[model samples]
Target: MEPSYILHTKLKELVGVHCNLAAPLHFLGIPFYRFAENTLQEICIKRGLDQKKLLLHLQESQKQTVVPSYQSLSKSSVDVVINHLKSTHMWFIRYRLPFISQMIQDIDSQLFNSPEIAEDMKIIFPEFMEEFIHHIYEEEDTLFEYIRKLYKAKQEGFMNSTELFYLMKRNSIKVYAQQHQDDDDEMAGIRYLTNHYQLPAHASPYMKVIYSELKKFEEELMLHSCIENEILFPKAKALEKAVVLKLTQASKLN
Candidate 1:
């Protein structure tokens, strides 16, 4: 089914038909849930990437520089940044990975062709899959874990060593950015799937569903990463820095 039609059908099931564009854009722009569809639409057009394709492509292409310290984060914006990372990056890792992993198995069982293509898929797709999962796992285990620790430290009214925190923060940012780039690469793999798999004239429902979901996932992921790299992360880092300065001053007074 055409993507728009599928989205429309899904929306109709949720609420009686209306002119509202919210639902379609909502799933497609998960972390930046506040953005208007029209705005996002403009961005997609400007980039010459369809909303779906753009989302998938960017998410597949993540490569971020790490910031070593929370000292830079403004106290006020830290919460917002944390929430965004947790919801978009952390939560997505938890939920989406299992679903994608399952789909991979399903695809393996059904989607196959000449031995040559199969071998090619093995080489290309496995690394793509590895990077995608590794990105998620790393964030969950290391990045998010550190964020939690920092938040806890913030709450307890104590600060860690400035230089050490800076070093770690920078590394974390690098790790996170790399993970994001990994996602973009993963989406590229999805594109490869769509192009390479010569679906039988009548693909089975399992095949159809798997590909459809993969397409949607990839598109949204690209949009999400664009927002993060271009708009969100810089703002977050600035906010963190501001917050850290204030905290430093407050401590000095005591």
Candidate 2:
């Protein structure tokens, strides 16, 4: 909305939550992307209505929903970061991945006509999903637990452990990251089969569900990846560096 346009952060704080309101706001004939640069009043004027009405709607709708607050996680504690990753891993494995695979299969098998296209579409979706799930499990079993241990050791006191032992177990963050194997290149297969997941104009309910769920899965994953690769990884590395430095200093004094 322009002169009165609110930044999303301000809107989130004013409205008391963080979320993606692009779809609903767009339906109101508001230019969703304008949200990046314009404020709410700018949008209201375009709709030829008072900005107050627009604000009211956004506030009312936004008030009820509670979403994850990533802002707080910018410099969050290790346990909080690990818990977020674990929660994200569980969601992908237990819900999002399975739901998308099933929806794609059900829609392709029942509604689509071409056998070759259907089979290709069916295979690619789950292949992409399963590979990503395996990657998540590896991190859960190894990297996340390693960070948790390091954090615990830091809290307990670096001097608590023997110098020889701590140095032996010590690793650069780069080494841990080198173990983070993620290749989503195969996911291009799903996109190719779905023609970039574009639905036909007269798409049925199931077709709509398939596209919508797939889109949500990607969005959730990008957010998940951002936390893991950006916020959590850097912070963990800093934490590790600080701990190692403390231990190294202690050893020199000894």
Candidate 3:
């Protein structure tokens, strides 16, 4: 059977409403290392009947270009970003993995009778476990490290948002509007993954419930990423550059 357009529409809406880049990459249908590239490949492969169809379908998804918001704040303030990160990314790491781990056990128990489902579950389960370890590292090594550096820099009165933006811009960092894969796009890939290229059937109450829950969580993660990547980050970059300019001028006067 063909994929449900309704689910796809609802999932797309979720991405439009909820995604934040501050969220963990894994929760956003990406792992930290090679997330963008690998995830794109994974989703496309998972959903498509074969490699060629997957690639072609992925190529057609819309791309977002962030336009900075006018709201002023410190570039490195970390408040909004942290809030988003905690709610979307950290929460998943801290909580969802354990629940999913339990679910995997349940799937394991059922595997003997349902070999195909069991095998698919096994494939993704171990991959996700390994991915989780890397997720932790990204938080500690990359995301948190950056946050700490930003905090220290802020404390030392080094620069504000505007200044930071300009500095990164001058350095050709390309920090803003980084053209992240959209959350809906990623979630579609995930639906492809979790459902194993097929929709949950009206077969049993158990299958239906599990399928529903997974879809819900996947949708939530995707939406969260969309908000951050498409809306929040662009605005943050602009604010950073603007504030940084003000700070630089103040320094010059001293």
Which predicted model would earn the best lDDT?
A: 2
lDDT of 3 at 69: 32
Candidate 3's residue-wise lDDT over 56-106, tens digit each? 443333244342232332243555554555556665666565545444455
Tens digit of per-residue lDDT, candidate 2, span 144-163: 87777778777876446475
Candidate 3: which stretches are off by over 4 Å? 1-78, 108-114, 132-173, 176-179, 182-190, 194-202, 247-254
5 in model 3: Cα distance from truth in Å? 35
Better of 2 and 3 by TM-score: 2
Candidates by lDDT, descending order: 2, 1, 3
Report the alpha-carbon TM-score of model 2 versus the true structure.
0.65
TM-score of each: 0.47, 0.65, 0.50
Better of 1 and 2 by TM-score: 2
Question: What lDDT, from 0 to 1, does candidate 1 have?
Answer: 0.49
| Model 2 weakest lDDT span, ten residues long | 11-20
Q: Where does candidate 1 stray beyond 4 Å? A: 1-77, 87-95, 106-127, 140-157, 160-183, 196-201, 243-254
